[model samples]
Target: MDRYGDSTQKPRVHKAEVMDEISSWDYVIVGTGPAAAEAAVAIRELDNRGKLLMLGAERQLPYQRPPLSKGLWTGKDTVEELPLRSAAEWDGLSVQIHLGDAVIELDAGARTLTSASGRIYRYERLLLATGGRARQPELAIATLRDRVFTLRNFQDYERLQAAARPGLTVLVVGGGFLGAELAAALSRQEGLKVHHAFAGNAPLAHVLPPTLQKVVLARYGKAGVQLHPQHRLEGLDWEDGSVRAHFTTQAPIACDLLVYALGMESNLELAQQAGLTLDKGGVLVNTELRSSDSRIWAAGDLATYPDPVWQEPCRLEHWDNAEATGRAAGRAMAGRSEPFRHQSLFFSDLFELGFEAVGRCDSQRVLRVAAPPGGGKAVVYYGDGDWVEGVLLWNVWGKADAAREGIAAHRPLMDLHWVETLET
Candidate 1:
């Protein structure tokens, strides 16, 4: 079963029709996420007369995804506020939308797409903002599939919320953003015992430096989260009504529910089927977010575009990246093409600690931490040799633009003394 618990059975094929004004769209976007929604709005703003159609596999309308893991649990935001744009707003743009139908086949040369419902539509311009699905473990068994959940969409959030009742033992796997945030959120529940298991010694070990990692781990502990560091999940077994999670080095732990946040695998099957240029990250796109086929474009988590700062193609799965790339791709499709130069920043809230970071904030790189003499908010600079690569504002606010500019400058660490000043 797919994420929605729907069978993967192929739908009956329907005959393809000759391209006509009725069946052809000036722009066809295949997604309902923020990327696709933003692209639609941008297209309508520039080319109001264009026939635009958006196809979404999900039944619900496009909604902001971050709140599913962050604000919803903390009562800062509600499900009612998740919609990116209401149905009336989309209708006002004259954008045709088809939900619960996914594009299963793509013919780039023909500029045609076949949906799972067997309907084929021709497009003058196509945007593949297919986004991604949650990555689950290899050892997940079929018998306990229902109990093993992966939170990606609103439906998954609903299911997980229903299962995460008071007094239930929940084992959240992975230490990445989603895992850490989910663990923190669930722990805040009145009586839920949340166990965070990951391969890293501390949460966000791959991104945050050792200092911030220690701070995050301590915060989670203080929030009543049971930390299972270095516990690489090996397998799972069904024990009565509970699920037993077996780790590589640690003893098996039983939990009432298991949720995996092992990161996302981009929906590249459509891109691959279309024979578009791809890298290990995602579909290769130029600065303007155009794929190998000039008529086709990609955005959001699936577009691995050239980074102006890193000077390398990077696939960023963050909200800012999605919105910026989607808008850029839409404008490009609308004949207002411009090289996308936005340096996307990502932020996360764990308990009371909040952070905003830009560029390649990898922990493996040389890191320099700048904090006040009294010890409060700090800034962490990641660099390679003499040049700065990324910056993290720990509990620091209103400096994301400065951080992005710093990364884009590609200046030596010695010359970028202004980074420390941002801490103030």
Candidate 2:
């Protein structure tokens, strides 16, 4: 059942006397996002009588984030595509929500939280669906720094989308997935010149290995994107018509606009203050998504939980991982003791070039298998010798579920042996 709201019906309200008894809730979800929204639904499924209170950092209702990065810019997706739940739908859940504010302080021992506005909330059990912040360097030209955008939330997307125009030179600073995707999408514009300036040698340096990089680089080259590798931006100079991105060693690259896709930093101030364990994978959690403090459970990109699929601890920022872990944490909070055995399905849309990937798609793997090319569509299997760890399908269609299952089984390609060559 959709826990957000029912448009066809009216909401039933409890009497003033009954409302007085509901001072606190059985569960308090502090970040009203997809994770928190899903958590509320999952909690209702587990215990109908459980009181649920949600606190959002923003006033707007939680929305889908994937569109903000890739789809929204292309005009293929409308503003309606951004929302995960409508105001009416979220109201239908009967969960008390305080929008436009975040929990600023948390006392795990006392099981209480204080918001930015100084309102205190108490929870029996909690879910840290707190999101991440945009990772970027401080730019100069304070007045025109408005041109230096970072795509994270809806507002940022709107600004960048409106500003990026044909003939506009955009310097995207980051070598990660978001940076590359933005470059690819923006480069597709008729006259827009897109320059990808990153510290890494190649785009998607943090992820995609040589096996997948070759194909991706080829696509970028075909698209005519100016790749500026190993340019750690030292400063920025704002011109009357453009902003110049300066590097410590390389020549200054000036652009009409600059948008940094430098990546995201997990919002961990509250989590860290609460003394939750932290690592490279954000906030650490167990197999069941329970944090060091038993009363708190975390999900979404902020959580670095055990990935049973890959037998490693992973902190993923994709929608699939967030949806999976959010529901899992909600269910676990409701007494489900099973480990997270689900695979994280991540997808990136670069105009026509899109991919659905699972565990261990990044570099540091020596294995790959390139099948025979059929009509420009190629299937590449990557993983250890025994199993298919990561699968890349070039121009393939409708194979997401099959790809995930294939990776899970770790099935090695039979007709083709594992090799690091794209020669088909």
Candidate 3:
């Protein structure tokens, strides 16, 4: 045997090695939410040759989740009207979407993933846009899990709409945006009795100012929606398909339908299992949206990345934030480096009222100014110093861009000079 005879002509030739084929892609993004969809589209725009795979646990194609609670209750078609992109657009994109299939395991070290069907997928880059799951009542009993509802997806709204017949007693638990929105929509159904167990003094105590909270409470009152303020759910009874909801501040109420809109819990199980760095219950990433593992990145609600504007680590779940973060991640994976610096855009429409704004909405102190009798708008400023932290354009249209700039501008909180300038 010749140990070193490579120079000899026709001495020895090694046969071509056959590599076992495993499912592989240039990019594998988990979760079919806004972040994942936007990321895939951006990636396709930049790199046409890379194989992209988007995994979603839900059966439905990727659709906007906001309208599910916002207006789906008003007889909107789930499949026909709710897609983020049209069918033709989806077909045009070179993305392999795995609907109803979820990636259950992620081996970051191996740069591979395993879906629920035992398929191994190797990826050059991974994005975990696996958005959060809706939170439910802690006292939910076993038999009642199916009966109780939470509005996190389009299907949930469809189910709730079917059960929202007249003469039904619906008990909504929570004091958050979803809870308020759902209760308001249900209250419009004549003959249906809607009771909202708000665990705070106001419907949106967590975000809205006390003044604005009053306005919301008044709206709920006018709509015939009963508000059980400062209340908490103790337990639930699922007997004969009816919910006997017991609350701490009120007596037991028997209801035909029970829906709770408690906040959401970030879907961090996969990231945690892979030993990714987590902080404040979210996967921590730098401004580039790169996670601790380097191979894996995160975006959307599940990602807590440094906010370049605020100079702090923040997690935003709004549609704009998701899209922005997703595009940023996609660009980076395509070899483009740029920090994602933008304010979060959030908006909510309840019944007939709608408002949109940017920047932080949490500020205890605000300068509330009412529009002149016919001005058709009002404004709230949360800035006390040079940093204009927030601005609320109540009933104001065509001012979102300017308002955002104002909030970003280092305007004095409120001075006679600034006030005169504002008036002018």
Which segments of candidate 1 are over 4 A away from where they belong?
1-22, 138-142
Task: Give all TM-scores, in the order shown.
Answer: 0.92, 0.85, 0.88
lDDT of 1 by residue, 116-211 (tens): 766789999999999999987765466677778899998799889888889889999999999988999998899999999999989889888887
Query: Which candidate, 2 or 3, has the higher TM-score?
Result: 3
Cα deviation of 370, candidate 1, in Å: 1.2
Ranked candidates (lDDT, high to low):
1, 3, 2
Clashes of each: 0, 4, 0
Cα lDDT computed for each candidate against the true fold: 0.85, 0.74, 0.75
Model 2 agreement with the true structure over 167-186: per-residue lDDT tens digits: 78898988877788788878
Q: Please report, as a residue range, the 10-residue window in candidate 3 with the lowest summed lDDT.
A: 10-19
Q: How many angstroms is residue 165 displaced in model 1 relative to the true structure, after the best TM-score fit?
A: 1.1
RMSD of each: 4.1, 5.3, 10.8
User: Quick one: best lDDT, which candidate?
Assistant: 1
